[model samples]
Target: MKTIAGFITACSIACSALAPQASHADTLTIALDYDPADLYGTLSTNNPMFAMLESLYLDDPRTGQVEPYLALSHEMASPTEVMVTLREGVTFSNGEPMDAEAVVHSVTVFSNPEIVPAYGIYAPMIDSAEVIDDTTVKIVLSEPNPIVDLLLAQIIVVPPDYWEEVGGTEGFGQAPVGTGPFVLTDWVKDDRIVMDTNPDYWGDLPENIDEVVWRTVPEASSRAAGLRTGEYDLAMNLPAIDVDAINAEDGLTVYEGDVARIFSLVLSSLDIHETPVQDRLVRQAINYAIDKQTIIDALYFGKARLLNGQVVLPGQPGYDPEMTDYPFDPEKARELLAEAGYPDGIDVEFKCASNRYAQGLETCEAIAAMLGDVGINASLTLLESGEFIGQYVRRELAPIGLIGLGVPNDPSFGIGVYRSDWRYSYYQNPEMDALIDASRSETDPEARAEIIRQASQLLFDDAVIAYLFGAQSFFGHSDDLEGFATNVAQRFFVHTLSLAE
Candidate 1:
C-alpha cells in the first residue's frame, strides 16, 4: 500500500486532464473520491448523482426535517395508502411535465424488482402506484409501512416518454434527464461528469455557480491538494488526518457534520464459507480483537461517534443505551479463538474498499495488525470501489469484509438487508426477521421503537458484525464558497451552494 502522499503523486498523471486547467469563475469543480456507478438513480446512490436529481421531499440539512419539494402535500388516506398532490407546472430537463402520470411511471420503474433490483431493499413495501388525477398520485403498499415517506424520498423522477424513447434503464444512464436544478451535459465515466444549470428548472438555482463539474480523484490527498491549488472549489470526503493541515492553510473551510453511516467489519455467517468465521465464538473474538476507540482517536481525531451496533446512532430513534460493544480485550479474543478450536491460529482473508470511506484502507490495515496480535492471521485485500461493490452485491465477499452501512431513516431499512429473503443478505435469524416485520407494521411510534431496539440488541448480542465507529461526514471547500450543506443521508445539495464575493 502506498502512503497518502505517494498515492496522490501516482494519480497525478490521470488527474492532469483537469487539474492543470483553470476553472471558470462561475463554474464549481467538486472532487469526489470515486466515479458514480450509474446516474439513473438506480444501482447508484453517490453524492454527485444526487446533485443531478431531486426527490419528492428533501431533508433540510439544518433541521433534519422532511420538507416537500415536488409534492405540494401528502396525506394518509388509509394505513396502506398515501395520497400525494404534485406541484403544478413543474417540468423535467427534457421539457416533459411532472404530473401524477409521470410520478406513477417513476414509481413503477422503481417498484419493478426485475427492472431495478436495488429498489427491492429500499422500497419493498410499495405494491402499486396509480394516478388519481393530473396532480394527484396514490400509493398502495403491501403492508402498513411506517417509513414510506423516507422510501419514496429515494425515488428521483425521470421523463416517462423520454426514458422509454431513449430505451430503458441502460439508456437513461447514458443520457439522463431529470427535474433537478442541474442538467447532465456530459459524463465520461472514471474521469469527470459535467452539468449545467437547467434553464427550465422549477427550483431556485445557485446565483453564482452556473456549471458544476465533478472530477473523480480517488486519493484523498490529491483532492485536498486540488482544493488547495485552486483547481477545485470543493471536495467531498476529505481524509481526517489532513483536516488540521487544511484548516491551518489560508482561505479554506471545513464543514463537519454527523452522517447516518457505520463503518463496521462483517464476518460471513453462512455455511458456504468453510472458515473460522462460521463459529460464533470466533466472530465474538473478532469483535473483541480490534480497538475502535484507538481508530476513532488516531484516524478520525475523535470526530466520529462510537456505535454499539450498526443499526442507529445515539440521537436516532430506536437507539438502545443498554446495548454495549465488545471491549478491546486481546486476551479474551485469544481465549475465544482457542475455545472455537483455533488454538494455534486461524487465517482469514479480509476484503475492504480503499475509496469507499474516509481512511477505510488505513483502518483495515490497522485491524489486520490488531488481529495478528490476538493470534489470528488476517490478510488484507484492498479493492477499488467498483470491484468491491460488485463482489458485495453478488454476495461473494471474503470471510471478513469492512464496509460502511447506513440506516438512513428507520432501523428496519438496515435490518431488511440482513434478512435471508433479501438478495444482499448472508445472515438470517428467524427472531430478527420477525422483529423487523413487526416493527414495520407497528402504527405506534413508541411500540415500533421498542421492537427495533430489541432487534438491535439481538444483532449486537449475536455478534453480527464488529461494530466500528459512526462516520462523521465532512466537506472541504475554499473560502469563496458559501451556503454549502450536506444532509444526514450524505446527499450534497449543489444548487444551494454559491460563490462568496
Candidate 2:
C-alpha cells in the first residue's frame, strides 16, 4: 500500500526520465464526464472538487487505510472524542492560515444539515468541533463512532476568513480557495474549469504543469477522439468497448484499476414510490433475474469483480466470504414474482445516468433486458450526470436506480444506506437499524466486525438491492502522461500528474 508520498518517491527513483521537467508541456487538458455544480467539496459527494481542494486525510488505495494529508496527526482521545493536529505553515491559496479554526469551521459547515442537506444520508455524528490551539482541534462526537477517523477524512478545509468574506458557501464556490497544489482560476458552467498551480503550496509543487483544464465532454466517443487528436491529454470514464482500440493506437494508453464502488440497482422500499419493489419477494426476484457476470463480461470486459448480496467488497472488513451471489435463475425469479402477487408481470421505472460511470448506461440497459426475461417490464430512464446525481442525493429517483455506491474501509460506511435515519434510504428495518447502531459504538474490533457481518447478512436476506459488480475504472491518456494514479474511491491525485518530456 503506497501513499502519495511513497508514489512520488518511487517515481523519482525508478522513473526519473518521466519526472517533471521544465521542458515538458505547461498545460494539461483533460476531459471529464460532467461539470461540477459547485466547487464547495462538502456540498456534494460525487464531484471533481478534489482536483483543487485538499482533505485532511486520504485513503490509501491498496490498504484502505487513512493517510494524513493536510493533517499532521489524528488521535482518538476517547471513544467519543477525537483530537486532530493540523500541519503548520500551510496556507490557503488566499493567504489565510489553514489552522484549527479553519478546520473547525469546515467541520461545522459540513455536518450542518441546513447547509448540506444531503449530509442527512450520513447523519451528523460530530457533536461539535472546538479549537484547542492554533494547530490542534478537539472534536466531540454525538456518540461513540468506530469509524470517526474515516468520516473526518471527508472534510475539505477552507479559508475561514475568505469563506465568511464571500458570504458563505454559494459565494465561496464561485471562486474557491484551497490549500491544494492547484487553485481555481476560471469556471465556465457546462463547459470547462481552469486551475493554475498554486506557487505558494505547502507541499511539493507541480513541477512541469502550470495549469489544468477540465473540459466537459460527456460522450465517450468524443473524449476518446479528443485524446487521439492530442486535444485532451487525458480522458476519464472511457467505455470498455474502446479500450482495445485506444491501446492499439500509437501514443495512447489505457490505465485500468479496481475501484471501491459497488454498482447496484437501489430498490425503493418506501411507500411513497408505490412500486412492486416495495415487496421483499419482488426485490429478491429482481436480484435473481439478472445475470451479473454476463453483464460484467459484456460491459466491463470481465474486468469487474462480481459482488455478493451486499455492498461490502472482499477485502474490506466484515465482508463475509461464505455469502454467495444470487444465481441467474430466471425460473426462480418468475416464481418469486408470482408469489409476490404479480402473477403475470410487473412494471418498474429504471433510472440511470448515461455517463456517470464507465459503460454505466449500457450496463443498465443490459440489466433491464435481463429483467424483462423474467416478466419484469422495466422502463429505462436515462439522465445526464448532474441531474441523475441531483435526484439521487435528494432521494427523488424512481423505484429502481442504477448507481455506484462508493465504499470506504469501514463496513459501516457501505451499510449506512440501510439505516432508517438516512434521508436517502428507501428501506427501513428496525432490526437492521439496531445492528448498525450496535456496530457504531462497539469499541472492540471483534464485536464491531461481528455486528457489521450480521447487518450485512440482514440486508442480503431482505434483498435490499440488486447487487451488480465492483466498478473497474479505465482512464485513457497519452502515453507521455506520468504520475497519474487513482485511489479505490476513484479519486485521482491530480497534483502528482506530470507530462514526460
Candidate 3:
C-alpha cells in the first residue's frame, strides 16, 4: 500500500497535461460542495478554512501518524504534562508574532467551556496551558492521555491581539487570521471566498500556487460541467455517479483517495420532540428497514464500505470485529415496531443535505421508500449544504438526521463522543463512559484497544444511531492541475497544488 504522500506524488506525475506549457494564470479557482460556516475555529470541517489555518501537528492520511508542522518538537515531561518548542519567527497574517502566548490562547479558546462548546468534548484531557518561555509552552492535563499530541493537532493557533481587537469569536468568524500558506483576502457568504499566498510563511517554500478562489457550486453535475468548460480548475466532492464520465472526458482527470468520513442517520437519543425514535426498538427497526448495502451498490458504485455501528472502521485500532451490523429485513423491522407499540406505524422526519455527500439526496429518498415499506411514514426534508451544517451544529435538526462524520486521525479522539457532554450526542451510558475514560489514559496499546472494543460493543448493542457506510471521495480537476490530494480528514491541502505544464 502506498503512503498518502506517495499516492499524491504518483498522481501528480501520471495526470495528463492539457497544454505544453504550465498554466501561467495567477489565479486558481476551485468549486466546493458547501459554504464554510465559521472560520474562527477548527470545529468546522470545511476545506477552505484549512487553507488559511495552521495546526501544531499534521496527520498522515494513509497512516495515522503525527508529523511535526508548526511545532519543531514536543517532549513529554510527565504522563500528564507536555512541553513543546515552537518554530521561531512565525507570524500570523495580522502581523502578530506566533509565540507561546498565541498557542496558549488558541488552545484555551478552543477548550473553553463557554465558547465553541463542542471542542470541549475533543480536548477534555487538557487541564491548563502556560507559557514557559518566548518560544515554548507547557500543557497540564487533568489525566494522562495517550493521544494528547494527536488531539492537539486539531486545535489551530490564532493571534490573541487581533482576536480581541475585532470582537472575539463573532468577528473572527467573519474575517479570520492565521499562520498558513494562504491568507483570506475576500469572503462573500454562500457564494465564494478568495485567498492569496503569504510571502512571509516560515515553512517550506516553492509553494507554486499564487491565488485560490473557492466558489460554491452545490450540484455535482454543475461542478463537473464547470471543470469541463474551464470555469473551474478543480471541483471537489463529485458525485460517484459521474466519476467514470468525468475521467473519460478529455483534458480532465480524477483523483481518488481514502477518507474516514461515514454517512449515517443520527438518531435523537432523547425525546427532543414528540417522535418515535426515542424508543430503542424503533431505532433498531429503522436501521433494519434500510438496506445499507443496496444503497452502496446502486448509488456509490462500490466506492464505500459498510460501517458496522462504530465510528472508526476496520483496519483501524480498537475496531470490534464481533459487533454486527443490523441485517436488512423489512419483516423484522415491522415486527420490532409493533413490539414497541407502533403497530399501525410511526411518523418521523428524515433530514439530509443535498450537496454534502455523494448522492446524499438520493440516498435519503431511498431510505424513505424503505421506511414506507415497513409502515413507517418518513418525511424527507432536504436542505442545502450550508443550511444543513448550521442546523446540525446547533442541534436543531429533526428527530432523525442523515449526517457524515468521522475520526480520520485517531480512534482515541473518536471515542470521545461517548462523553455525556458531547455536543452532538444525546445519549449517555455510565459503563461506556467508564470504558472510554479508562482507554484515554491506558499506556498499553493492546489494553487500550480492548477497552475501546468493549465501549464500541456497548454502543453497537444500544443502536442509538443508524450506522451506515464509509464513502470514498472522488476529486475531479483539470488535467493541468498538479499536487492536489485530500487527507483522511477531507481537508484540501491547497499549498501542495499548482498548475503545471
Candidate 4:
C-alpha cells in the first residue's frame, strides 16, 4: 500500500524552516523535459526545472496565507489594493538592488508589457503597477483580484539592469539573468542543460552538490532505459507501464504520487456538449466509457486515485467532501452514445502531450479505448511539453486534447485555473465566476467555506470537464535518502536531504 502514514507527519513541518541537512556527498543529475534558457521570457514555463538559477520576486510555495518569496511582507490596504515591502539587502544575480520600482518594471514586462513567459501573449492584466518607494510597491487592482501576489511569483522577475539591456520588450530574450538559487551555465536544446549553484544564493544551501545536469528523454522507453543504465539518478516523465520493472531494478526507486492537477474531457458548452463533432451525450458517455479504475490499476499500478468530484484533493482548506466520483460503467457509456445520436460508432481525435505528467499518454490511450466502447472513435495526437503548453496550459482549443495542471497547493490558486482569464474555450461560467468572486471576498471562514462549496457544486453539476483523479504522491530515493516532503509540491529545500551512509 506504499504506507502513507508519513504524509500525516509531513504536515507538521514548520513551513519556513529548512529540512534537517543531509550528506551532500555527490553531484546530482536531474532529467527534465528540455533545457531551460537564460532569458526569463525565452524559457519554457515549467522548463527551469532548475528553479535554483532563476528566481522570482515572490516564492509561491511557502506563503499561501499571505505572501512569501522576495517580498518581506504584504498588506491589503483595501480589498482591491495591496502594499508590498521588498526584503532589504536582496540583489539580483547581476548584483542590482531589489527595489520596488524595479519590481514594478519587471512585472511590467512579465505581464507581457515586455519580456513575458515564452510564447507569452495576451495584452497583460492589471490596471497598473505603481512604485511607491525604494523597497515598497503598491499594486492597484482593476477589480478585486485577491490572488495578485501569487500571480506575481509565477511571473518570474528579471533585474531592471539586465532587462533594459534586452532592449525593452522587443529583444528581451537575447540574454537572461535571474535571482534564483542556481545559475544557468549552458543550454544545448534537446541535448542537455547544465546549471551550477548560485554562490550568492539568498536562502540556505544544499549540503555539497555543486551542480545539476538535466537532460531530455522524449520517448518513455528511452527515459526508462536511461534510468536503468544509471544515465539519470532522478528523472521526470516516467510512464505508468514501466513502474514494476523500475521497482525490481537494483539501486533504483520509483517515487509515486497524485499530482494536484485534474484531467477532464471538456464538453464544449457552446452547444451544451451537443455541438457538431461533440455532444453532451458524448461527454456523458465518455464519463461512463472511461475505465478510470483500470488506468489507475493496470497502467498506474494503483499509484493513483479514481476521482469524480470537480475538486480532487480534500486536505486543502476549502474542499468539499460530499461530492462523489463518477462511477465506471461501460454499458452506461454505450447507452449514452446511442442517445447522443451515435449508436454504431463515431470517430474523433484527442490530443495529448507525449511526455509531461507521468502516464500522460497511457491515460489518453485508456480514454481512447473507453471511447471506442461508447461508439466514439478516437485517435491521439501527442506533442512535447513546450508544444503542449503552447496549446493546452494556455488553454488553446484546437481538437480535444489532454492537459496536466500543476494545481497549486493552495485552494484559491488551485481554483484560479478555472477563472475566466484561464478558462480557454471549453470554460465559461457567469454564475461560477460570481461564486468565485464571493469566495475570494468573504473573509469569514464559515462564509468562505459556503462560497467554496457552492463553487465546487457549480463545477460538479456543470461537469465542465470529466473529473479524473488525484495523484497518489510519492518520492523514491536510495535507502539512505531521507527528509524529502512526499506531498505534491515536491520542493528542493536541499538543506533537508541527507545520505544515511
Global lDDT scores for all candidate models: 0.78, 0.78, 0.77, 0.58
Give the lDDT of residue 216 in candidate 4.
69
lDDT of 3 by residue, 164-264 (tens): 76556755665677888877766676788877777777765324467788898888899989998999999988888889998999989888868577777
Model 4, span 295-359: residue lDDT tens: 77787777667554756366765677777766788888778777767779677767777766667
Candidate 1, 1-501: lDDT as tens digits: 223343223333322321223344588899988987777645547767666667777776756777787888789999889998899999887778999989999888887776663545756678899999999999898888777777767667778987776567765655567788877766677899887777788888887887889999998989989999999999889988888888889999887766577788777787777888988899899999999999989888888877866467666668788777899999999999999888998988999997977789899999999999998899988888888877776777768999786556566666677776665666778988888778778878889888878888888778878888888766799989988777776766887778865
For model 4 the TM-score comes to 0.79
Backbone clashes per model, in order?
0, 0, 1, 21
TM-score of every prediction relative to native = 0.92, 0.90, 0.91, 0.79
Worst 10 residues of 2 by lDDT: 11-20
- Candidate 2 per-residue lDDT, tens place, 1-501, comes to 333343333322322221122332488899987777677743355345666678788765544477888898888898778899899999887788999999999888877776752333344677889999999999888888777667767777888877776567765565667888877656677788777777788888755788788899988889988999999999998888888999999999998867577888889887788888999999999999999989888778878888877677786667888888889999999999999999899988999997777788888889999999999999999888778887876677769999887655667768877787675577888998888778777878888878888998888888988888887777899987887777766677777777876
Off by over 4 Å in 2: 1-25, 60-65, 117-123
Question: Alpha carbon lDDT of residue 262, candidate 4?
Answer: 60
